[model samples]
Target: MTVHDVTAPDQERDREALMPEAVIDDEMIASMQARAGVNLRIDHSVNNEEATRIAVTKFAGGIGDINPLWTDADRGRASDYGAPVAPPSFVMACFSGIQFGWPGLGSFHCATQARFHQPVYWGDTIAATCTYEGFTGPKPSSFAGRTVTDHFLNTYTNQRGEVVAEINWQVMNFERASARGRSKRDDKKQDLTLPHPWTPEEIERVEMRVLSEKPRGDNPRYWEDVEVGDGLDLLTKGPIGLTDEVAFIAGGGTPIPRLKAHAASLVDYAAHPAWSFRDPVLGSSEPIYAVHYNQAAANAMGVAFQYDVGFQRQCWQVQLLTHWMGDSGWIIDCDAQYRGFVYLSDVVELGGEVLEKVVLDSGEHAVKVKTHARNQRGADVMPGHATIALPTREGASPVTLRARS
Candidate 1:
């Protein structure tokens, strides 16, 4: 369990660097509570179009989003932002991490709720901070037995100090070994509950749609025009496999034995992966990053097989809405709650329908979409929804979120 620490010292001030130092317990709860409201300011620079394009594209690739507004220079420039803007969820990259230590227990993203007040453009500097919202703990769960929930709220601002985004995020911690047995039993039961293996043709058809998608680009989805029952095209990824998982980590920039230097650049802003344990199946050379690649580690953490990262699914939800809302629309809010596991080799189908439509007091037109990610078995594993402000044929998109006071 002696994985190498490749990051140099003096990488940002390790605010949460003290984590995995000990097991999370009553003492840890009190310690974190004492430090509530403490802010960790991390700044990221998007100095040029290429910088923004590369950053956003890497993230979009992780979720398999092929929208031209995020990938093509010509199409992006012609879009409403006048240039390629980061996806509404791109802010997730700037600042995430609870700052509370969870050493032994596997962490699960339970809920992610975010609000965007302004669009992020290239050449802007984003300054973000994370503050502890408090804690709820020692709860029982079939998923994470002996679970505890911690809340971390992140506020994102531009160089001008205008608040552009906020994320109210939560993660649950549990005893891994204890949860493993329950997970296996439930997984088998759930598999029995579902019928039908998706045919190769069915899988190929959806994969094509995901690749062929253009993001509703240039075509503005007028607000006053959307009907409640309008449905989105089915966006799918996989009969998942190693390539998909590895690609996600490549874009996500997680710690890999040989990829240490690449991960070191974000040392100041991102959490360090000090998982010292080696996967037994993969043997001594394996870094803890193998949780997604090593079946043994996956089981130790309560899944029979390697699984998709919850945050990855969160990105999928973001892509789902942007695909439907078009480039001219803005996603002002998004919330996702993970209900179950989506393992490697699972087909994930994503889509949504207009839940409601309304006009704000500011005269901004909007649509609320109920979106979700379902496994091949047709079980919904990630249920989410988003609110988008759309442009109108009568006038341009109005300023819905007023400038920060």
Candidate 2:
């Protein structure tokens, strides 16, 4: 059948509105689950250096990390590792944007529990697979009687079939009724007592440094020159390291199973699953280093070495824009595809430019931009788009009204 005969215009438009190009099915879900649980081959050769670099950059962006180790080869080489390394969270930046089937997956409220096994290097060709772990929860909701839960476990291995990282993620599919019942509240009440805490002198120093280092290229993007349909160059991020990874996991209250085992032996441990360190969100009493900093357990898990969490990449992307654009711009929406694994000692670079511009009905200048992050090897680990509001070039004045008494 011809394209016109097979898909009607209305149907095509509806499909585009609902989801991405990939179509997820039951069989695909089952297959992904099975493969994730056991060993499944999903390999990608390291041919795309640019893509790798982008992945690392995006991961670094998520973490708000400006460490020279991930950006400068000379500084990285001076480190103990003797070379640049990718951040532990680089895996998330490098891999998540690629299409993996499981319909309604994005609709769920997602959370991740990731364990790093090894350090991925520049030339390593990695393979990965994800499995379904099952589902949980059906808590009462105002709209639908029950909500659905979906769980997935993913593992990535290198060329030698050694597992580098394992991730357990949960997604909560809330019913529409429950969502509609929630109270509408304005959540942005800022504390004004300590606004602009920085001294004028400190602010001047920071502004000078930032202005001097503002990313300038042959293709300069001045505020006045920007217009609709402009494409920005891609951004680069990481060769991540253990220090940053440890900081992130510890800061975010991430739990590690192996560390828990150590803690249980030292103290009187609780028997509850919620109390177990294996539980991603609970069981934090003291600082533990076995999972993130130890090298022995990492090798046992078939990883080249200790690495970082995958979700941190998301954080890096958020950081990139928040820091650069200041609080005035908001992250209206973002979506990423995971492509490859990121290991310690790899450098990443990330940057992006505007794509389109339009004036909203409210006269706000809305700009849509495409952004991406890459690693040292030039692989595009994460690529996505964003929208922002900026001051208009026209310099429109605010409206004023007078009242006659």
Candidate 3:
């Protein structure tokens, strides 16, 4: 598990440039503008209760929040929702969704601002869609030689037509030459030190803790009793690997649940080879967006290794508050920031503390938590904050984040 494991694929890719080499120029910017308002993901319906449970289970397991409320059907059914609830962040997994990179160009998911509208329950059908809001840049960005920001609006609605969540996500697409030059020129190198591989005993202990996780489902975490510095239950996850990454991606991006959409994409790519890149070694073709986890694509992006898909880290934070607040709680707002690389063989340990607890003018009770996820070396990779609403013994209503039937 040395840096070589992460960097090997990158070396092979250095021999040739990846496609979609659209440099930041007048023509490219104009094309982007004209494409604004176009739907990036077609509207579609998805329903697969069994897959929802399994998807969230894997999603939660990766982050360490194996709340039975999200993973166990029996426990979930006995509680309030009458079925398991998907993590508030599951929508992100959907939005990282079917990534379509700029033709021959690399794309990076840098940040997301998501507001939860309603909880997605198991058995509920969902219709989802996304539109390109437009481009905003040629502004300064250290990550790209000159970067332009692409903004997208994603919406999820249940079969009842209730909005599940609306997300405004931003990704930066840029010129690779400047990015590569800056990466090579920088004297301070990224710390890719391999950790002592986990022994049998250590691995067993971690697995035991994960199995022992208990969710605070029906019991209300009243705002009146919560303190300013209360701690949340720790859900330790990962020494995650390629299987975990592939399992997540295979879950699907199409409006239909599970692998249907992603499978359809594969079939479409095979029928229309123009949409995919053929890998001689893997002896197959893949979508242009495969760089999110493909080592070759990571290398092409000038990264030292294949890294954590951004949603894996982002959704973990959502699992944090949801586990602490119980099924009755609602996530009002979350702002997730991805700072550095989380390469393969990296374990992200996360924890959060209540920053404040107060009652809004509307008489709704709320608490804010600041959370951090650090790699094995203790370097912070993902830092985020979330506002959560908790029900009250005093009868104060939790703040309403989603208003739908």
lDDT scores for all predictions? Answer: 0.66, 0.43, 0.65
| Root-mean-square deviation (CA) per prediction | 8.2, 22.9, 4.5
Q: What is residue 308's positional error in candidate 1, in angstroms?
A: 1.2
TM-scores for candidates 1 onward, in order: 0.80, 0.39, 0.81
Off by over 4 Å in 2: 1-62, 65-225, 228-238, 253-302, 360-363, 393-405
Show the lowest summed lDDT stretch of 10 residues, model 1.
12-21
lDDT of 3 by residue, 1-405 (tens): 243345366765554335445577777777778989898744322323233666767655545555667787887666555566777766655544444435444566777778877778766666667888887877776766678768887787777777878877777777766666665545246534443367888778766866665667667788878898988766555676777677655543321112333578678766545355554356555555455467655655766556776666677777767767887788888877787777766667667789999776766788988888876678778787888888887663452233222
Query: What value of lDDT does candidate 1 attain over all alpha carbons?
Result: 0.66
Using alpha carbons, what is the TM-score of model 1?
0.80
lDDT, candidate 2, 182-214, per-residue tens: 311111232221112445675565445433433
Best by TM-score: 3
lDDT of 1 by residue, 1-405 (tens): 111346455542231112122345777667767866776433222112223667767766766778867777777567666665677666665554432455567677788898888877655667667777766877877665587787888787888777888989888877776676687567666533222256788878767866776667667778877889999767787877788777766564323222343345335224544443443333343344456766656655666667776667787888888888787888888899988777776788888888899887767888888887887777899888888888888887533233222
Worst 10 residues of 3 by lDDT: 252-261
Candidate 1 error regions (>4 Å)? 1-25, 40-51, 187-202, 253-274, 285-289, 398-405
Q: How accurate is candidate 3 locally (lDDT)?
A: 0.65
